[model samples]
Target chain A: MTRPPPRILLVEDTPTQAEVAKALLRDMGLEIRHAETAGRALADALANPPDAILLDLELPDFGGFELMQKLRAEGVEAAIIVVTANASVNTAVEAMRQGAMDFIVKPYAKARLTVTLNNALEKRALTQELKTVKAQLSRDRFFGFIGASAAMQAVYRTIEGVAASRASVFITGESGTGKELAAEAVHKASPRAAKPFVALNCGAIPRDLLESEVFGHVKGAFTGATDNRVGAAKQADGGTLFLDEIGEMPLEMQVKLLRFVQTGSFQPVGASRPEKVDVRFVCATNRDPLAEVEAGRFREDLYYRLYVVPVELPPLRERGTDSVLIARALLATLSREEGKHFRGFSPEAERAIMAYAWPGNVRQLQNVVRNVVVLHDAEVVEPAMLPPMLLRAAIRPTAPHLTPMAAPVVAPVVAAAPVVAAPAMAEPAVAEPVPVQALPVPLPEPIFVPVPPSPPALALPPLPPPLPSVPVIEPLAVMEKRLILAALAETSQDVARAAALLEINPSTVYRKLQAWKTAGEIP
Target chain B: MHALRLQPLGLCHRLGVWVEPKVDRLASRWHHCHVTVLDPSIAGQLAEDLPRADFLLIINTFRDDLARLTQELTAAAATGDHHSFHRAAHSLAGAAAAVGALRLEASARLGMADEASTAPPPPGLSARIATEAQAALAALAALAQGPG
Candidate 1:
C-alpha cells in the first residue's frame, strides 16, 4: 500500500502567508495543517501529533519562543523548523540556544526550507539514537563509571585498553560531562587501582601556591610553610593523578610540571636536588587545549605531550536519551538515599523532563531529579510537583484571560472637566482585550458588549476616560475572548494556547485590571 | 477577583556530584611533564595528533557537523553515487569517533564501505559528498583550537 506524504502542522496567524507557505511545502508533497491561533495550534498538535511542525515566530496569540517552550513541555518531539520573519543573528542564536533544530530567515526559497527540514530530521534522528544509548548506559557500570551511550562505551573501552599501561591518558569534555568519571574509571582499572586516585582542578589554585601544592614544601620554605607537606604529585606517585580543567594553568607552572612528567623528579620548596617519583597523568578540561595552543594560552609542547592517548566524554544532550535514562536512575538512587518511597515521574512529568533543553547537561538533570524526590510527597510525582518555572515553561502559550472591559457610556459625574479631544482616527484592535468586569473601578453607565447588536450598528460610543478610543466595538475583543474561553473550558484550563492567548507581558495587564473583577463592578 | 492563592508547599532536593578539587592542577603539571618528553615541533603536526586534553571541542565539532554529514550521506544514497561521499564518510568516521559520535562514525563507515564495493560510482555523488564533507570537515577542524 502506498503511504501518504507526512502531515505537518503549520502554525501561522496570517492567512496570506499561511497559504503561501502551505503551497510551498505542499509542492514538495508534504500535507499541511494550518493553525492561525496558538489555541488552535495546540489543539491540532495534541489531537493529531504530526510528524513535523512548522512554526511561525510571531503568532497572533503567542510568541514563538514561548510556544516552543510549551511544545517541549508537553513532550512534543516532532521535528520543529522555526519559520520566522524576525531573523537576526541574535534571534537565530537565541532560537538555537532554546533548542530549535534549524533556523531559516524570512524570504527563503522552498529549496532552503527543504534543506533545513532535512537537516532538522537528521538531527532529530541522532537525538533519538543518543537517547537509546543513554538507556543502556544507565544500567551498566564499569568501575565507578555509569553510562550506556556509545560515547560512554567507547570511554569504557579506552579505560580498559589504557588502565594497565603506565603511559599517560588525557580525558576531555565540557564542564559537567563526567570527565572525572572517565579518569576514575581509568584509575580503578589500572594496576594502582587499590591506591588513592588523587584528583585536581588546575584552574582553582593560585599560580604561586600551585607549585607547592603539587611538589610539596619544606617547613621553612615560605611564610605559610609551617610544616613539611607532601605535594599532590608526590602523594600520588604510585597512583593516578587526575588533572581537571588543565587549560587554565599558568605558563610558569607548566614548566615545573614538564620536569616532573619527564624525569619523575621534583624538588621541595627548600630543597635543592630533584626528588624521584612515579605517577600517571590523566588531564581533563572543558576548554580546547589546541585552540589554547594556537591562541598562545597553552604551550604547544604541553599539548603534544598530553595527546598521546585521549578519552573524550560526550555532553548530556549529545548522549541523547541518556539524559532521561540517567535521570530515572538518579531518581532511584536519590530516592534510596533520601529514604523516600518515591516512584518515578508521572506521564506528564516524564514528558516535561524529555522536552527540557538541558544546557547544564547531566549535572543539571541530577539536581532536578534530586529536588523532585526530596521536595514532593506523592509516590508518583505529577507534572504540577515540578518547579513553577518548569510548569510555567510547560504551559508554553499562556494566552492571557481576556475580560470584556466595562466602559462608562458617560464620563464620571464628579470628575474634573473632560480632557482635550483627539482626532477620530480609526483604531485597529491591536490592544489586548481587558475584561471590563474585572476592572477595579466601577463600570460606566453603558457597557459596550462583546456581542454584536441584533442589527448591524454603524457607530460606537466614545470610549470613557482612561480607556483609549477603540474604533470597532462589535465582535472584536469580546468575540475572541469568548472563543478563547470556550477553548480553555474544553481543555480543562491547560492553557497550552488552546484556552487563551497568553500576552507577552501578561502580569502587567492582569495586575492593572485584577481589582475590577474582585470589586464586582462588572462580570 | 485575582486570588493570591498559595498552595501546599512542596520541598525539593537537589544533589550534585562533588569533584575533588586541585587534582586537575597536579594532573596538568604532571601532564606537562609528559609533553616535555615529545619534540615541540610534533605538537602542532596533525590535528588528530593533538592531545585530547579537552573533549568539548570534539563534542562541539560533532554538534556542528553531524547533521550535515547525515544529510550528505542520505542525499548520496538517494542519488546512487558516492565517491565524494566515500571520502567524506571515511574522514568523518574517523573524526566522529575521535569526538565520540559513535553513531555518526558508524554510519559514515558503513556508507564509505558501501561506496567502495561499487565498480563505477553513481552520478551526483561527488557534489553531494563535497558539500556535506566540506561542512563536517570545517566544523571538526575548528574543534582543534585548545584545551576545550
Candidate 2:
C-alpha cells in the first residue's frame, strides 16, 4: 500500500549543475534520472514518465521553452520546474507561461531547491486529485446525458462496467432516449478515448449505399462514386464504431456486417482484398430486437454477436423527476442560445412538465424548451408558455371509478333470463324479464303479448339461445391513421417532427397526407 | 591534481593545460602569476552549503568546462570568428558565476561586449581569460581539498 518515491527527471547540459541538482533531489528521498540534452530528456520522459522534471534552459539541442511545449503537447502530466543560470524576469515569465510550475536560478541553496520541488509535487498531486473528483462528478451528467434518476444511474453503471471490455455493447431505448450519448460515454470512458469514435445511423442511409458507407469504397465503385472514401469502420480503428438504429439495417447488409463483426475485416466496395481494423463495436436500436429476430428482420447470429452486453435506457416518463430536471436544464441552455433572459420555470410549469408523459423523451423536451425560448421572453416560464399538447395531456383526467349500477349488467340478465322457464313466462305477467340480445335486433313493430296465469303441462323448450355477440375490432389501417393524426396534432402539424416522434420517415408521412387529401379523407 | 584529472572531459582537456601546442605553451606560461581567483564570499557560501561529495563533483566538472571553453575562446579569437567568440564568452560567464568565480565571469562579460566591435578582439584578451580561468581553477581545487 505504500507509494513509491517521486521520480524526477533532471535535464541539464552542464554536468556540474546536473550533479548538484541530483544530490539535492536525492537528499529529499526522491529518485533521479539525468539527461544531458533536451532530445534525450524528451525520449526518456516519454518512455517512462516521471513525477516531476527539473529543466535547465540552456540545453545543447534546443531551448528549454521549446522542450516544455513539446512535453505538454505529448500529454506529459509531470510538473516542471525550470532551473536556469539566467535570472532574467522575462525568462521566468516565459517559463511559467510554458507551464513550468516553478523557476529557480542556478547555484540555489539546498533549502530553496527542496521547498520548490516539494511545492511542485504537492501541486501536481492536488491537480490529479481534482481530476478524479471531476470524473466522479461526471456521473450525474455523463458525456451529454443529464440525469440522476435510479434508472439513469443503473445505465451509467452498466456503461462504466462494460467500457473497459472489448465486448460489443447493445443499447436499447425508446427514440430520443440518448442512445448515441450512451455509446459516446462508453467510448470516452474506455482506454480508446484518445482515438476516434465514429457513429453511423443505419436507418438513415439508403439500403443500396449502406454497405459502401460502412466499409468504404474505391473510386468508380458505383455509378456516382467519383473518388475513394474512408468509412466509419476504418475511421474508428483502435476506437469505437457506433451503429445506430441497427434494427433498421437491411437483412442482406446484416449478413455482411456479421462477417465483419466476427472477423474484424471487410472488403470495401469493388476491392479485391479485405482491409482489417482494430475496432470496438457499440450498436443501438429503439426497436424490440428480439421481436426483430423472431420476425426474421434481424439476423439471429448477428444479434447474438452484437448483443453481448445490453444497456436499456428508461423512457422519460419512467425516470421520475428527471423530466423536470432535464426541462430546467434545457430551459437554461435554450435561453442562453436564444439570447433570452428567462430565469426558470414557474412551479405550475414544472408540475405540468412532470405530469405529461414525454413520449418523445429528451428530444421533445428540448424542442419544447427551445420553442418557448424563441417565442416568449419572460422572467419565468408560466404554464401558458408550455406547448398546447403538453398542457392538454397534463390536465387530462384518469379513468373513472365504476359503481355497481354503472357496471355491466348484460351477463347477469342473460344468465337469469333462461332460469325463468317458458311456463312461467306464459302467465299473464307484465314484469317478465327480457333477453338482452333482443336490444340490437330490428323489430317490425312494438308488440307485447300477455301470458295466461295457468301454466301448461307441456313446457316449451327454453327460448332458443340468444345469438352470441362478437367483439368489435378496429382495422389496422384505421388504427395507423389514428396514430399518425394524433402524432401530427401533438407536434402542431409539423410533419417532420411528428414523423420523428412516431419513429417513421417524414416522406412517408407526407405521402400518406397526400393520399388522404386526394381521397377526400383529409382537407 | 587527481580531482582535476577525474573530470568527464578526459585528460586532453585538463585544467591549466591544452592539447593544441600553441595554447598549451601560452597557458603554461600564464599559470605563474598570482591574481584574485574567486570571490571568497560567493565561493565560501557555496562550499558551506553543499554536501562534501557534491561539492567535489561540481569542482571537477567546473575544471573540465573551464579548460574546454578557454580553448574554444582562444581558437575563435585566433580566427576572428566574432560570433563564436561571443557565444563562448556568454557560456563561460554563466559557468563562472555558477561556481562563484566573479572575476573570470566579469572578464568573460567584457569579451561578450567587445563582440560588437568591427575590429578583432583587443590584444591579450584570450591570455587574460586564460590566466583568470587558471587562477579560478586553482582556487576551486584548493577549496575542494580544504576541510569539509
Candidate 3:
C-alpha cells in the first residue's frame, strides 16, 4: 500500500471539473480526493495526507501561492502540481520558487496528466537515491570535503579539469571557505602529484623580501637575504606554485607575476638573463577581484589571466547538513590515523553543528572536528568537546532561516541516492514566509460603483501625484552598516575589518558587532 | 409531487408582496406552492435599477433589511402597498434554486411572475399571497425576537 500508484489530491472548485479529474486519475489507476476551496483543501490535507497534490491555481477563497505556503507551514511534504491557466514563465518560476513540484496548464488531456505524474514520481525517486549515496560517502575524507555530494563532485570535476593545465587558476570565496585545500586537491590530483606542491601566503610575506624569496637572490638582494636561496616560484618550477591570498598581492608584483604567467619566463632578482620555468599558477583569494579591479587596486588584465576557470566555494553556513556530513568524515579520518575508536556524534554535538553559523567555513569545521576527536575520551564526540567559542556561537539566533541558502548547496549531496528509493527528500524547501503578525485580514467591501457606460472594475488605489515620495537613509549610517556587514562576512565574522569598512572606526564596529554577535547571520 | 409549468411575462418584479406594483403583479402568480431559485450575480444587476422597489424586495427575501428597505418601500408600505417587497422576494425566490428556504423562494418567485402582467390576479394568487405574507411576517417577527 505504501508503494501503491501515486495518490493525488485534486483541489478544484467546480464540481463538474472535479468529477472529470477524478475519472481521469481513476483511469490511470491512481487514487484521488477532491476539495472545493483553498480553505477546505488545506483542512483536508492536514486531516489526511496525500503523496502529491494537483492544485487548481484559481480558487474562490485564496490564491495558489498563499495556499502553498499554508500547506508548507503545516509540514505537508506532498509534491504539488499547480494546475494553472496562466502561461507566463514568470508565473511558472514563481510557482516553482514557491515550492510547487511542477506546473501544468489547465485543459490538459489524460495523457499529459499521466506524464506529469510519472515525471514527478521519478524525480522523487531520484532524490531519495541521492540522500542514500550521500549518507554512504559521508564517512570518507579529511577536511570538510567528505561525501560525493554533487556540489563536491562538481568541485572534484573542476579540479580534475584544471589540475594538469599549466594555465593559471583562480579560486574565490569568503574566508575559511576552503579555497587553499581545493588548490591543493587539484595539485595532488594532477600529473605533478609526486612533485613538491609548494604554497606561499602572498599576503603574509613582506613586499621588500617577497621578490627575492620567490626568485632566489645572490645572498644580498635584501636585508634578510644573507644566504643564496631559491624563491617559491623557482623551487616550484617543476611542481605547482599555489599563491594563497593572491588578493593581497602588491600591484607592482602583480604585474611581474602576470608577466611570468603569460610567458613562463622570469629572471631571478638581480639576475641578468630571463630563465624559462615550467610551473603551474594556482591562486586563491577571499576578495571579489572584480570589486578590487573597480577600486583600481588589482590589475584588470592580470585578473582575467588568473581568473580563468574560476571555482567558487560555498560558504560553510550555506552547506546545510553537509556540515555534519563533512564533520563525521573528518572525525573518521583523524580517528584511524590517531589509533582511536570513535562511534558517532552525541545528540548535543549534532545540534551544535546544525546550528552554528560557520563563518570560518570548512577550515573552521575541520579544526573543530579534529579538536573534538583528539580531546574526547568517550567513543562519541559531544557538545562539551567543541571549542568554547563555537559552543557559545551555536546557541545564538541566526537571522533569516538558513534553508534558502542551505538547500541548494546540500541538494546535490542528498541527490545521489538510488533509483528505487522513496522520493520526497529532493523537493525544494518552501519559500520564506511573510510575517503573520504583520499581515492583516482583507475585508471585502463594495468598492466598485457602476459607471455610466462601462462595466465596473474595482476601484484602484489612488496614484501618487507628480512628485514621488522617496525615502533616503542617512549616508553615514547606511555606509557604516554596509561596510560592517561586508567586513563581517568577508572576515568570517572577524570584527576588525568590518569596523574598518565603516571608515569611522574599527572600535565602533567592534562594539556594535559584539552586541550583535548572533551565529551565522554575520557570515 | 405536483409540477407547475413556467409562464414567462415581459414585465419585471410583478408579484405583489410589498414590492413595485408591476413586480407584485408578476410575483403572486408564482409565490408559494412553487420552486424558485435566484442567481445572486444576475439578480444583483436588476436590483440596482429599481433601488427603492428592489430594497423592499431584498428585505422580503432576506427578511432583515427592514431599516434600508423601509426608506424605499415608504410610499408603498405606508399605503399598505406590499408590492415592492413582494417583487424583491419573488426575484430572490427565483434565484434560490439550489440552497435557500424552498417554500418561501417558490412563493416569492410566483408572486413576481404574476405581478408582471397587468391582468387581475390569478385563481390561487390571492390565497398564496396571504399565506406567504404570514410566513414573511413570522420570519420578521422571529428575527426581531432574536438578539442582534
Best by TM-score: 2
| lDDT per residue as tens, model 1, A414-458 | 133222233354532232333322232322212223332243121
**Model 3: per-residue lDDT, tens digit, B1-148?**
8886443321222323344344344454544324333322223322332233333343343433322232333343344444564444333342232112334444444444444555433334434434554555454334333334
Deviation (Å) of A361 in candidate 3:
1.1
- Tens-digit lDDT string for candidate 3 (A326-411): 78878888888777788788766775676666767778788888787777656888765665444323432221211122111111
Best DockQ among the predictions, by candidate number: 2
DockQ of 1: 0.01
**Deviation from native of the Cα of residue B8 in model 3, angstroms:** 92
* Runs of candidate 3 exceeding 4 Å displacement: A1-144, A333-341, A370-376, A384-523, B1-148
TM-scores of the models, in the given order? 0.41, 0.44, 0.39
User: Per-residue lDDT of A1-523 in model 2, one digit per residue for the tens?
Assistant: 4878998999987665676667666668888999988999999999999989999887767989999999999999999999887678999999999999999987677778899999999999899899985666445677788887878888988998899999999999989999999999999999999999999999999999999999999999999999998888899999999999999999999999999999999999988899999999999999999999999999999999999999999988787678888988888888898899998988767766776677788998888999999999998998777765454333332101110121111221111222221222322222322221122221111112223343422211111122112212345456457667876876678787566444466888898889999999999
Q: What is the C-alpha lDDT of each candidate?
A: 0.59, 0.75, 0.60
DockQ for the candidates, in order:
0.01, 0.23, 0.01
lDDT of candidate model 1 versus the reference: 0.59
On lDDT, the leading prediction is: 2
After the best TM-score superposition of candidate 2, give how far the Cα of residue A69 lies from its true spot, in angstroms. 38
